[model samples]
Target: MSSPSDSTACDLYDADRPLNMRCACGRNHGRGAEIEVSPDDKLEASLMKALFPVDSVRRGFLRAVGANTARAAIASVLPLGTLQAMAQDKAPLEKTNLKIGFIPITCATPLIMAHPLGFYQKQGLNVEVVKTAGWALIRDKMLNKEYDATHFLSPMPLAISMGAGSNQVAMNVATIQNTNGQAITLANKHKDKRDPKMWKGMKFAVPFEYSMHNFLLRYYVAEAGLNPDTDIQIRVVPPPEMVANLRAGNIDGYLGPDPFNQRAVFEEIGFLHLLTRDLWNGHPCCAFGTSAEFIEKNPNTFAALVRSVLTASAMARDPKNRELVAKVIAPAQYLNQPETVISQVLTGKFADGLGNIRTVPDRADFDPIPWQSMAVWMLTQMKRWGYVKGDVNYRQIAEKVFLLTDAKKRMKELGQAAPEGAYPKFTIMGKVFDPAKPDDYVKSFAISKMA
Candidate 1:
């Protein structure tokens, strides 16, 4: 059984706070105490109330604190036995023989490997792998119900949950798919080894306009002392078209995931500038998300689906499962690469342009605080950039996007351990961020354009 005083990092509050004080540490609070509620803060608080009404009780406890904060905190207190029971005792999902959608990329390894290796089956799921053109298309499919769920960029689901991207029904990320596989590739033309200043007039492409790939690129250019919007024109292009765009000199550089990053180097189209892993340690790059309706209608399937991801991720992380993943992702339509290529990328090895080869850093080995913090950070960006129209509370939406309680329950079932914080914490670009201090953390970043 769990107690309110327990110190699990997933525990939203400690014994130190006023009982009525909320744990807004990550998703709900804005950094620390806002001594005075500005118009913006008032608007943020109002939006929170709309999503999680102030009067709502959580876990049978009338909220003594902020509603959403209490809602999230109470959800995190589920006992391990109860979690296992939820997985075992719930009626099997309405749709067990599931056809899941994914873009053909290495990041979808968990779903691909899970399906063939019988991991989903072990969790009582019958999963069929469906491929999509890109993240945008995948989003549409997930929204249209063409897919039960799909491996998605973590921010996409959050974007939806907050009503940032589409007014369609909200979706939620049940678990992280894979992290740290994305990279920013620069065209060789912009790769002037002799003159670093030559990049003063270049266009860099990002897969989506308001995406982490774009955010990371902006941060990188800012760190290099260049204006992201003015110093270098940032172009928006699809991931598959990034290399071709580079080859055609349509854009100078772009950020994308593995294989595409590798293929660019292999074909001499661009120079790999930096992997996201180098920028944000263990950033939650992608996840498995489904609509709220799907979840409410089929809780049993949701638990099973989460269990499958856990098992598959464990296998992919384990050296013994390397051959298994290679075999699973071998279909030409999928990762569609040779066994050696799949092996190299999946286990963190990469092909150098030279005859020599080496293992690049593994970015997936990250704590969970980064995930929680980034959720809050993305919301800030959305508001700052006008991606979200009208009055919307950033903090309230962060709660729905994060779904920390569900993630914790799933993690507990997987037996995979996370860091000792209620949320994942890490430094990005040398700035230390604790989700507990979301507003301060957002302020710490050099870019303050998030409205």
Candidate 2:
């Protein structure tokens, strides 16, 4: 094989493979050798164009978000020593040593992993992970800046952005935090009637009536020819209480996040009918969202935050990071399951009550770009359900709420990869599916209305 240092025009030098393809530039390498230049190398291009073909710009609007390279270019004009000192003395924003709220779940693993793994400290940020009771609290605290940010539901940002439950605030979501951890579970009584067509009437519990979970359930019920408003009843219940309610027969079914889904299985209280991710492949599920003001006032700080989450997300997606994530997410304060149990959940493996462990099939994972699509879809559903006022344009609501451009800019600065090769894309149930037109996408949904 040709050596990378042979000057073939690629900017990487190969090293031994058994220990991973380390870069000759002295940076520890993992699978990054597959890319021409590692983003950690401080290369000139934004992380998006580097990993994806530069031609992808024609395909997606994310590429339209310009790079803030003027700062770096301006720094290059300064004396070398001055640049070095500037880098060394870069004090963190007054926002350092802050608390960020999050609910306990496997999806919150990235935030938990970042702290002990040194991602936050590396970015010159000191973040305390505070556990909250519900999304409403997470939203309230984040809005007031009482908590810097949170491991929030993907819809939370859009909902807050549109002022769905409160005031309109410009929030920024740059990186998709985690995906595909949600499930729609049915009580044991309904397990035999797995096919929705066989059931005439059923009651479902969603964390909130207007959340993405609610819309997803409505969509699935609609697919089954059940009218959400008349055929099925959707009640609101916290995720942690879902398993108990299912066991006690208070609710017919529940849509919830894991390890609660895992807990139901372990306790033999409910059977998972389908994972929420199965509703739409590769959908935008959850992300790191902050205020619009935060992005403008502290671009560098915001970029660093994006980079930290990006790094954590990459690690979470890697198979080698299983034990690390399991240990972080399965504490008594978090999931309350054993690390081994959490490990199985992370790897998509499960143990039934009879001590039979099985490998679960690969499910569709979350992608960043789908976040905007999900927001738009939610807007349509809100209007359809009469949750929000009439005459609300979903497209306009999506643009105002989801800050794809701001996130793209930050991703480029930190060298994190971005969506390319199509501005209008949709992810349904963890699959990177696409629609020809936005108007057609909304019209295709029978349970939602046009913007």
Candidate 3:
């Protein structure tokens, strides 16, 4: 039995190749040329080339010092072995144990389910999906770095990055959590006042000032020919408290995340007045993101986290897994909502609180692609509503914050078809929004708060 070190030079070289082709160690080595060298292998080869400018010098030095001695010397001098190892598989992840924050909403389905479904564990990560009190708390904890990553309103990352609502700390939206899963749920008493014209002086609740729920509610009412600012009042209420507020008569209705919207119906307090999907079929509702600093420091860990969430997103996207997902995430450790209510939201077939069963399968969807156009749309809305002012570089900010490149790579890695084009046109309330002309889209809104 030949020892590893006693192997012939040709055999040693052949070991590195995919196929064992015995060839002289020369410039034109035989069939071994066809073998692909991995990144780590390339690193090692490059280092060897740099260390000895002449091939004869390298061979003589290796022959003199021996392979084991040469490896020890290289490792001691420059950490060549470590560098090669890192180049091979992403440096063993900068982090393994992580604390992620989330609100108990269906928008966080992928993130929440990742914990119970062992997706994080599969990625060699121990993730704690801490159920936060509300969106504001989630934002605060994320900003403080109390939680490594958190569920964000799709607009929140953009807002945070631009310093619109909080201190400008660069954030990145890794993937959209859910889309078209929100609804304008009104109190049962307001059933007679379905028209926005009759909603004058009505108090409404939104999860956050910088949330898609707020933007969608504003747009919906504005399209109904009512000024969202003065004609109706919009308060920032947590989703968990939406049903309670509605039942207490403190709020007339809320455009909130589920299963709160569906929970209201189950509790006999509110009716689903309108699904946000009716206004925009594929509107982004929430996002999974972390600070840009975190990603820079822990690229591998962040990639693993993205893979885990995207895997969960892929699972959540299938209609067949909706019931199972609802069951998996409806426990006290997760969403903490009734399984039936959560099932109704995830399954997309539920009582509208008006005694009729409504079926809209895409009512709550888990599309993880973080399209840049979606960010552009959010920016346009932000400009239209005066959340942002002055000349806005729509595409620049969209690309910076949305992480479209990262999303595309991860989606492709998971065998999902990545969406083409960063700026795809979308229609909101029948108005075409071309991302190329975001300023025009903002100007086209008649009932805007833009100065």
Candidate 4:
């Protein structure tokens, strides 16, 4: 037997596990009845007691105003739904405050947009997306623990982990930030010399030594029968300065990230010679990652970060939503470019700076998967260029750094259609790259720095 005063009857009333002889409390002439007290009913009771404070007054007020009227009054003033959510979600975060670094490029679309849209807050994180000056600064900050995570040029983690261009620090790429969002832009002065073979004796710029921009530029020039080292000059320049440098005639052209590539076109200084997607249709350009040490210390925080970014990635993948996304990220605090320019870069329709409008929708895509094979391909380039010397255990390094399994798990949890397998073959410039035989692929390159 249970009375209305009993918490078991008032709060823990489960219909399947009903208490025998439950008091109806004046209902049906005081007969025992099967009753179910909901969470709302319990909340209403608590709120009523708080409002009245005296039992006699609470009973009198409820009797006069009625339960339905009381619930409406409580909900209007108190936002009971928010209270319920706060009560239900009590998972303590390992870290709530974090700083993420990024360059002012459209490649950082997902991570950058997550800030303004409250995705980080939704996961109980207070993330500050810091705008970095250059790739070297981004690497230095990450190494010194100044940034918890960063926007990495996709090959950066592989290079940094292998001690190629910097002191070795283990980094893990959580997601490929953007793919196919880069272009080979030449100054308008060299519009007649569009062919790569003619690009010999010309100075070129890349964002970093370990960037896909560098490798792709090297591959493109090599295919045209020119040694990238001897026949031409390649310099490392920050993405934001790429257009300004071109305008000042500091360099002939650059294979750089957008909205800078588009910025070059927008400013009328350079023309889009070719999109990198023309060289390798889906080549990865930028990535979002943190140190492996950070992941080990704050696994939950890292998972939340990935979720926040991936959610933005899923939203940005829709072509119709791109213009809206551009508006959100183009303000001073984020990418700091004109909305129209960012929209042009994101929406994939723009002027080529050569008197024509071009539309290539996958020109920029938010594919979050960091395939291990992508890591292996990057490694082969690193070896071929002598950035890494001798036999590389390609598989071991690829699996350790890329984190394909974790990405797929998080994507599936968010109901995004994630693919199976860690390795997928890609054809770059009509040559099929087999990730399984990385050594053979490295040797096959005709003008490799490899002995």
Return the top candidate by TM-score: 4
**Alpha-carbon lDDT, every model:** 0.62, 0.61, 0.81, 0.82
The per-residue C-alpha lDDT of model 3 at residue 193 equals 93
Candidate 2 — which residues are off by over 4 angstroms? Answer: 1-92, 352-358, 364-371, 412-415, 421-424, 427-436, 444-451
Model 4's TM-score against the true structure: 0.81
Winner of 2 and 4 under TM-score: 4
How do the candidates rank by TM-score, highest first? 4, 3, 1, 2
Give candidate 1's whole-model lDDT: 0.62
lDDT string for model 4 (31-56, tens) is: 23433443334444434333443455
RMSD to true structure for each model, in Å: 19.6, 12.9, 16.1, 13.3
Best candidate, lDDT: 4
Backbone clashes under 3 angstroms, per model? 10, 13, 0, 0
> Residue 228, candidate 2: how far off, in angstroms?
1.3
C-alpha TM-score for every candidate: 0.73, 0.73, 0.80, 0.81
Q: Give the higher-TM-score candidate: 2 or 3.
A: 3
Per-residue C-alpha lDDT of model 1 across residues 1-451, encoded as one tens digit per residue? 2235543222223223222224434232443322222321232232222223332322223335643555454333212333244346555567788878887667778777666544565556767888776777887787778898888777788777765567657888776777787877777766554233457887778776557777777767766776676678887676667778888988877777666777777787776666788787677666777888888998878878876676567656755445546655766656666666566666666664433466764733322222555676666555544466555554566677666677677767667664443345567778766656665655555544552
Candidate 4 residue runs with Cα over 4 Å from true position? 1-91
lDDT of 3: 0.81
* Model 3 pairs in collision: none
* Candidate 2 local Cα displacement, residue 81, angstroms: 23
